[model samples]
Target chain A: MQLDSILFYLFAVQILFSALMTITRRNVVYSAVWLISTLVGVAGIYLLQGAEFLAGVQIILYIGGITVLFLFVIMLVPVSEESKQRRFSSQLWIVLIVAVLLTGELGYFLWQGADSFQMGEPTPPAEIGTVTTNSEQIGQVLFSEYLLPFELASILLLVAMIGAVVMAKARPGAE
Target chain B: MEEILDNPYLQPIIATLLIVAVFPLVAGYMVLAERKVLADLQVRLGPMRVGPYGFLQPLADAFKLMLKEDIIPAASDKWIFWGAPVLSTFTALTAFAVIPFSDKFYVADVNIGILFILAMSSLGILGLILGGWSSNSKYSLLGALRSAAQMVSYEVPLGFTTVTALMVAETLSMQGIVQSQLDKGVWIAFSNYGLMLVPAVVFIIAAVAETNRAPFDLPEAESEIVAGFHTEYSGFRWALFFLAEYASIFVICGIAVTVFFGGWLRPFANVGFLETPLNVAFPILLFVVIGAGCALGAVRVTLAYEKAIMGVLALAMFLVAGLFAIPMINELIIGFFWFLFKVLIFIYVFIWVRGTFPRFRYDQLMQVGWKYLIPISMGGLIVNGIVLLFTS
Candidate 1:
């Protein structure tokens, strides 16, 4: 239990640090690396939750695929060292202040509602094994209970593919 | 605190750290071995001056890396420049956590070990990308872009081939897959899946391409890209990138072992006098006899028989050593040896290709990945899925 807490805190620290680094780093590339670290921490949290598949997907899709794309685009666009130092707008201060205030209020409410929070009984060890159901169960769920969402996701992917093709194509007579 | 420390779950975490700590040192030596192999292939002695036969080459290289001055390019983003290599190395290390060394050896033994490895392996691309971008150099940027495309493109076939293995094994767990092989008395690679060989072969090629080893090493094509994304890095930081690359090689080989070869399992069936409990004592008793033979210098008198005797003696020592080691440690050693053996074969193939074949053009490389490997893998997966459904 204490180890869990430590891991949680460690992940929280990573999140906060990476977030700060992402915004403040002078290099665009460094900002992306920080973002990768942020994603890794989130993946770690998922692992802690025993969602191994989700954690793996998070790392693969977000860190590997998405971030690599970001890096490729960044590399193709010739941004100078000086330009990378561009600061956030002054209005960001107001946004930060509001965010802090909201967090404080949320924390206060959570504390007040602590006694009312319904803590469930500890799950049995055997239940943990069930959490790692074989891929067959996942396939079944995808084809049945989540069929609609699955089809929607495929359609969404199709639309994105078309959009990408259109964007990559040169405008008529423009090239 | 006591509860957390004493929890059984903590064992995996501790075992993971122990594995991570040792893997890099082993990987460092592997680089030295690669150099030696390359030299031998080219009919030259490689780094013979570092130490006796360059045995201490990795150590010498380590010391040199540590003592060298750290350089952060004036035009580069300092933090990302530093962070990229660390990220690369860390992601590479993390992938090993789930790789089953042998049937009983692994850190976490996660059910989705294959997926975990694939995912973690992909994450290293982020570091390469960031390293390239932060270097503030045109060459680095180009190298990074090429690598990103190469990795993403190759990953498709890699995953598909793995699915094919999963189909044959009827299980995702690495150990379970090995056990399936042991039960059948046939390896998955040699199984009745005829056309499945296409994807398996493609997958092995893809693994090579993904790791950016020679012939496919266009990402760091020294002639063109001037060391690629890591062009600007120096000192220990540079060493980290090398460590990540070699470590990923091991990770890829381990995945191949789990997927195609019987991971951590002996190829032949367990045929011995030790088939029964009473017979199990025979191997140990034989070891005592060999030890006595060696003690009396009888081994020298019978050189041909001594060699055969020594082989058996070595196996006994390994088994005894494995018995004394922790379960995870035992698995790791067995897995490491299995993984190393396979990787050495792959490395030889890598070296052989480097010596024999010409490098692929960037466009050709892209074409092979997208047009050839991808479609084949996708088709293989479909066929494999069908076969699996029928078999199950």
Candidate 2:
């Protein structure tokens, strides 16, 4: 129980730090790294929930694939310190005011809901094995119970892929 | 608390750490082996000066690497630059956690071991990207971008190949797959789907490209990219990159073993043997033999006598071969040997390809990945799915 608490706090601290860094970093590359840290923290949360496969996919797809692509594009753009320094003054103030109010509201709600949201007992090890059952179960569920959603997701990905290819194709006059 | 401390999960975690700690040392020696094999292939002496027949070359290299100055670029982002190699190396090391060295020799027997490995292995690109961007160099950045594109393009096919393997085995657990193969004498490679072989072959090729190994190594095309993402990195940091590369190699081979070859199961499993009471003892006995060999090699190194090292190395080889006497452990030890042998072959092929083929032009490289490998692997996957559906 103590170990679980320690792990929870550790992940929480990592999430908080990375979240702060993601918004606060001046360098775009550093911000991307922070975002990765945040993603990994979330993956850790997934692992704690015994969703090992989901956690792995989350790390692979989100952090490994998407974020790296984000960094790749950012690097290719040639943004330097001078260009990055330009900041909107009034717009920044407006953004800051909105952020503070949203944070305050979320904090207040969380504080109010704390008593109502008591921690549940940990799942027994025997129950956890069901989650670890081979891919057959996953396939069975996906093909039967979740068939529509699975097909829908595949279609969504297919559309996204086509869109990406169309966007990435070189234009006639462009180098 | 005592019961929790003795939990099975702790065993995997401890085994994982143990494997990670020793992997680099093994990888170092693997480099030496490659050199020796290449030298033999080319009719030349590889590294006879360092120790007798250059046997101590890895150790010498380690010392040199450790003593070298760690250089950080003046304009580089210090933290991310430093963090990149560590993250890369750590991810590569962790990928082996779920890899079954033998039937009972695995650290984590997670149901989704394959996915876990694939996911962890993908993180290597993060290190490359971070290393490149943080270096604030154009060459590194370009190299990073190329690697990112290559990894992203290849990952889809790799996942598809895994799905094909999963479909056949009807299990995602590495052990389960191995067990399934054991029930049939033939490897998954030789099973019903002939087209499945195409994806396995394509997957290996893509894996080579994804790892930035030779011919496909345009990202670090020495003559072109000027050493790529780690161009500006030096000393221990550079070593970390090397560690990550070799670790990734081991992982790819481990995946190959799990997916295509029977992971820890003996090639020819007899039903009578499996049904016998002795079956349970077989895997453990096999582990002990292999473990003892490794321990002996380690002990010989500690003694630091040339004769002892040679004697122990020879003994290790003999013990490894003699493992065949025990049918079950034979498979596990042989699987380990087979996995290493295959990986070494790939590594040599990587080097040989480097020596033989010219680096691809950037556009040509992308074309090979996007145009050739992707379509072929995707087609292979579809064919595999059809075959699996019909056969099963």
Candidate 3:
């Protein structure tokens, strides 16, 4: 196989394996570590697809920020007590049924091939003589075409931040 | 054979190997330099026994560390404890892949170079956090939490200051930033009608905090926490953490140099008249002066071995200075010399700060990051953006 395809398969296998480990691990911290591995594998796939900007964001936001927070929380909690409890609940049959149905649905979609999705051909990345880089293109499109949605998202985040602060703050009347 | 050598893939592999092999030695010497600087600042003679002027102190320290017994606490999480330092070292070294060392000597000039570095350094926090948590000690846990919190908090200002530079450069590539500076005839730190200096100052402060250096080094404050996160770690594992620390220091300082100060540009780079003098003659003159100092020391010292070692060092320095006089070799190495000169200045300043300042209280560190730095960096970005908009 070509090195590109080999790399893709490697990342694919790693993502799947780590995702499984993430969900299956008894220790929450171990699970978080596995989740980081899974996220990094996804980033590798993004890099393989030439989406360098997206890959960087994936690693930074997910592995760096979110996973570190998850680790922090994991360290804080009574993890030994939690780990002593059962890994699964009495609702296993229902979960198994849902899992099987989801797998079947995903398999069916994969078997149907690309024509069923009805997506257009994607534009190739810029070359030497082309206008700017992929990052620049992303920036331009984000600002110009998706300006409203971008601004709205920023406002939404700001609202969330305020809500979090207020929720965490002590009541004025109560010490 | 020619085709094999010409392969595009081979260069990066060679560069990677070269960095992996050379960086440890560089980091070791950086430690020696730091100790010597610290000693000088404190008015004490440092490490005179290992080699003349303690030149071989890093090598001796490395040997001693390697020979020491490895210890893993009985209560510690064995796997994580074993892996944490390795993880830290790996991430720090990997960040070097995107760092533009000079005009020609870089591993990979990725499009997202700065972000790649930021991501790698962020990942390095996990090493500290995991090492601390795995140690299963209160001091370790506290240190890790402080480090994680400090790094995360400072990263906001660091990011903002970087964004300000990126706005001026309009590129994320390390090499591209240097090229932008060259093209504009000004470093980003001095650009934007001098508004860029605000972010530059903030960046320096934030970078210092980000790397957990003194004055912001609440994470590993020896007085309170007993070496903090690596308290339980011993011998080579501890050395790995030290390696990661110094390597990250180099990487962070490198980013500042690349983004703010012109990466490999000589002083007065744009001035035509000063080019030959600053670019060529200055390094030679500087090294010759250093070699002369070494020779004088060698003559003054009474011990035979110390005199011999000093003489050898002086000879080596003179040889290096002589090499710079050759046109071909000078052309090849001048960029690297300028780049390393700036980085050494940065490293010296880091050690100087460590020597001069007392450790910050945890609350003060947090206040500086969140309250002072964050606002200043944001305002600097806005001001620079406005300046760029009107001036351009």
Candidate 4:
């Protein structure tokens, strides 16, 4: 087997396994750690697809930043040693029904496309996975073509920041 | 087999293996160097009982750490605690893959090299926090909390400085940054006619805090916390944390030099008058000075063993000097020499500041990072962007 396929299967299994463990763990700390494992496994999948910059960002921002923050919040919350004894979540039946319907819909699409699956590979865009580097291409497009949207996103973030400070600010009458 | 031996794809693996082998030795000496430098700064003798003015202290320290009993507290969560040091060491070592020591050297040159390091650093903090939380102790938890806050907050300025730097360089690969510096004939810190000085200051301070070094070392504030996150850790596990700390310092210093000081490039690299003398004489002078210091120590020491040890030290330094004197070897090693020379200066400054400065009050640290460094770094970034826009 080619190294690419081998790596893909390995990371694929790892992500699936870790994602399962993340939801199943009784201990919140263990759950947080398993979540990190799942995040890292996804990063490996990105790397396999040659999206190295995305892989790094996934590791940095997701596994590194968000997951660590999760752990921090988990630690701060005063919970007992073990979770409460209720085994299944209250919404399990509804969730299961929705999940089964989603799977049936996906299966219907795959069955419809089965004959076309063996067709020759679709060509990817030249700007991606080609002579042009994906990171540079992403940067050029984001700054030049999608520049307005990007700037608007930053504006949204700035507004959120100012609002947070305003809400947290000390009021003279409250004291 | 021959083809496998020469495979271009095998290069990074080989380089990584070499680094994994040599880095412990390098980190070991960094500890020794820190001790000796800190000792000198305080007007006291450092480790003298080890081999030859503590030259072999790193070896002795390693042996001792290995032999010492590994202790896990009863209250501690065993698995996460055990895995923490391993995670820390792993991330710290992985970051080395992107550090450009010379033009021809480095394990990997990914397009997102700096981001790769930032990712590693952020991930590396998990090890500390996990270690602390798993230890199930008050001091450890508090230490972990402080580290989480300090590192996360300081990461903002670090990100800004790095973005500003790569903006000026117009590339993300570490070597490309150096190449851009060579082409532009100016370091990023001195770019835009000194407008970059603010971000440079921001980077150094943020880097220091990020490493949990002195003045910003709230995580392991010895007097207050009694070894902080690793309070309950002992023996080899503690050694792993120690190794990770030194490795982190080395990597951070490497990034600083690469981004700001011009990695592997000598002073006045473009100057027509000084290339030969600067390249040839600099390394020779550096090694000879070290060799002469050992020789002097050898003469001064009264004890026979101490004298003999100093003599060996002098011989080793002189041998290295002699190797660099060779024309073929000189050309090959000059770039590595200049790179390490600059890195050593950085390491010295780290120790110097540790000796000089008091640990910051937690409130003071937050105030500096949020209130001062962030706004200044933002201004630096804006100016850098404007200059690039106009000049390009």
Candidate 5:
């Protein structure tokens, strides 16, 4: 096999194994750590391609931000005796069916997009011009074509934040 | 192995390895410098007894720390307790890979260099929280929680300020940012006459807090938290924490310099008359002054060891001065020197602020980060965006 294939397989294996471990681990903390490793592996896959920006965002947002939040909850909550008992419950058969269906869907998508998913070279977005950098191109798209959605998303987030604040606020007369 | 070694990529890898080797040594000296400067600010001699003017204090400290018994609490999570420091140090050092020491120098010039730095440094927060939590100490947990909250909060303003810098540069690559500054004939901080300065100021404040330095060091407030997250750590584990802290300080200050101040390029680089003389004389003059001080100290020192060390320091300083006197070496080194000099100045400000300011209360720190810094930074970003829009 070519070196590129070797590296891809390595990263893929890392992602898959860690992701598996994330769900299978007994301890919540261990599970979080495994999830972080899985995220890192995914970032590695992004880097192996030319998606440097995506790799960074993957690590920064998923591993650093979201995983840390998961860890915080894990650290704060007291461990219950039931938590370490088993990885699955009575719904395992149903969950297994769902998982198999999801996997099949993923496999179908991969097969459909196989030719497009060429390693190293991602298909460049339309309107390719002097702006070659991924980050700049992202900004251009986000501001120009996706401008309304971006603004609306920001507004939505603001509304959610304000709602959270209002809900979190103590009543004027009561504690 | 041979083929891999001979690859063009090996050069950057070798350079990275060299940097990794030198990093700890530089980080060690930073701690010593911090101690002595903090002492001087408070009118004390600091570490007087170590090799000439406490020059070797870091070595002594390192030795002491290494020789001390490594401790893990009986109830601690053994694996995590062992891994936390290594994780912290590794993540902090990983940021150096993309840091442009000069225009041509860096391990990897990734397109998303700034984002990579932000990501790596954020990972270091995981180290802190994990270390604190796994220690099985209440104080440790509290410290880690504080650190997580503080870092997460401050990161908002920090990210905004970085976005502002990126907007001004219109690029995310570290070298690209510097090149933009050079092309524009003004650092990002000084661009738009004065409008961009607010984000720079905001960046500095948020960086200090992000790095968990005083007045933003609520995570490790000694009086309240009792040595913070690494409270249960001892010996080499504690040293790793210290090393990571200083190295992050260096890296963050480096980012500040690269983004706000011009990286590598000398100030007023476009000016015709001042450029050559300023670049040539500045390094030489600095070394000469330091040599002279060392010479003075050498003459007055009583102990033979101290005298010898001082004499050697004086000689080394003179040697460096003479080295910089060469036009060829000076031409090559001037950029790197300017970048380092600016970084050092920022670091000095860090130490100066540490000495000057009392630690902020946790609530107050959060308030400053969220209430003051974020809104202002957002406003600054909008203003910058508008200016860039008009100018473009």
Candidate 6:
């Protein structure tokens, strides 16, 4: 096999294995660590796709920022007692139903193949050539075409942040 | 053989191997340099007994650490404790892949070079947090929390300052930033009517904090929590953490040198008359003076073995100076020397500040990072952006 396919299989296997580990682990911290590996595996996939910028953002924001926050919260809570408790929740039937539905949906898509999705064949990695322009092209598209949606997403984040601060703040003279 | 050598993948692989082989030794010597500088600042001799002028001290220290017993706390999380230092060291070394050491030497010149470095550094904090948590000690947990908070807070200003410089340089590529500086006939620090200096200064301050160095080293403050996160660590594991810390310090300072001071570019690069003297003659003269000093020390020392060691060092320096005189080799190494020279100055400044400044109280550290440095960096970025918008 070509190197590209070999790498694809490797990253796919890593993502699947790590995702499985993330859900199965009893310890929350261990789960978070596995989740980080899963995110990193996704990032590796992005890198193979020649989406360098997305891969970097995936690492920085998800693995670095968000997962650290998750770990911080996890560390503060007493987890020794929590881990010894039962694994499965009362909503097992609901979860299994959803899982089966999702699997069926994925299987259907696989059976239908590329034509049914109405998407074109992907641009080959060779055609993409130098990776430097990948980010520039992303910037051009983000700013020129998707500018409004992009700004709206940022504004939404800002509002959420302000709301969180307001909620977190001690009420006036509550002390 | 030619086909294998010509493989694009093989080049980066070789570069990665070279860095892995070389940087641990470099980090070792940086520790010696720090101790020597700190001693000089305090008016004392440091590590004189190791070899001649303590030149082999790092090697001796490395050997001692390696031979010491490796301990794992019985109550601790064994897996994480085992993995944490390795994780820390791995990320630090991986970040080096993007660092443009010289024009010819780098693992990969990926487009998102600066971003990749920043991301790696962010991931590096995980190693600290994990190490602290897994140690199962209050001091380790507290130290880890403080380190996490400090790095997270300071990263804001660091990111802003880098954004400001990236604006001026107009690219995120490490090599591209240097080329931009060359094209503009000025370093990024001096660009935009000196407005960029604010961010450069803030970048250095935030970097010192990010690397958990002195003044801002509240996380590892010996007096406070007894060595912080790695308090329970001993022997080679502790040494690994130490290596990672210095490697990250080098990486951060390297970014500062590349973005602000002009990586791999000689000072007065645009000035034609100064080029020959500064680039060629200056290094040769400096080496000659060092070689002469070593020779004098060799003669003055009473011990025969010490004198012989000093003579060997002197000969090495003289050989380097002689090599610099050759045109082809000069062309190859001049950029490397200047880059290293600037980085060494940066490292010295880090040590100097460590000696000069007192440790900030935890609250004071947080306040300085959030209230002072962040605003300054943001203002610098916005102001520089506007100026660039108008001018260009």
Every candidate's lDDT: 0.76, 0.77, 0.90, 0.87, 0.88, 0.92
- Cα error, residue A67 of model 2, in Å, equals 0.3
Off by over 4 Å in 5: A1-3, A80-94, A106-132, A172-174, B1-7
RMSD to the true structure for each prediction, in A, is: 6.6, 5.3, 2.1, 2.9, 3.3, 1.7
In angstroms, how far off is B156's CA in candidate 3? 0.3
Report model 3's TM-score to 2 decimal places. 0.96
Q: iRMS of every model, one decimal?
A: 2.9, 3.0, 3.7, 4.1, 4.9, 2.4
| Leading candidate by lDDT | 6
Model 3 misplaced stretches (Cα beyond 4 Å): A87-101, A118-132
Candidate 1 residues B29-125, lDDT tens each?
8878788887888899888665445656888888899999999999987877888899889889988877766544467666777888888788888
User: Considering every candidate listed, which one attains the maximal DockQ?
Assistant: 6
Per-residue C-alpha lDDT of model 6 across residues B78-138, encoded as one tens digit per residue: 9999999999999999999989889887788878999999999988999999999999998
The residue-by-residue lDDT of candidate 5 on B67-144, one tens digit each, is 999889999989889989999999999999888898666787767889999999999999999999899888999999
User: Which window of ten consecutive residues has the lowest lDDT sum in model 6 chain A?
Assistant: A122-131
In order of DockQ, best first, we have: 6, 2, 4, 3, 5, 1
> TM-scores across all candidates?
0.79, 0.85, 0.96, 0.94, 0.93, 0.97
**Candidate 2 vs candidate 5, TM-score winner:** 5
Error of 5 at A23 (Å): 0.6
Cα displacement (Å) at residue A54, model 6:
0.6
- Over A35-141, each residue of candidate 3 has an lDDT whose tens digit, in order, gives 98899999998877667889999988998888888888888876779999976579989999999999999898899986678764554544421223668878999
Candidates 1 onward: DockQ, in order: 0.44, 0.49, 0.45, 0.48, 0.45, 0.57
Scored by lDDT, model 5 comes in at: 0.88
**Per-residue lDDT over A87-158 for candidate 6, one digit per residue giving the tens place of the 0 to 100 score:** 757998998999999999999999989667876456467432144666777898999999999999999999
Q: Quote the true-contact fraction of every model.
A: 0.63, 0.69, 0.37, 0.56, 0.58, 0.54
If you superpose only chain B onto the true chain B, what TM-score does each candidate give? 0.81, 0.84, 0.98, 0.97, 0.97, 0.98
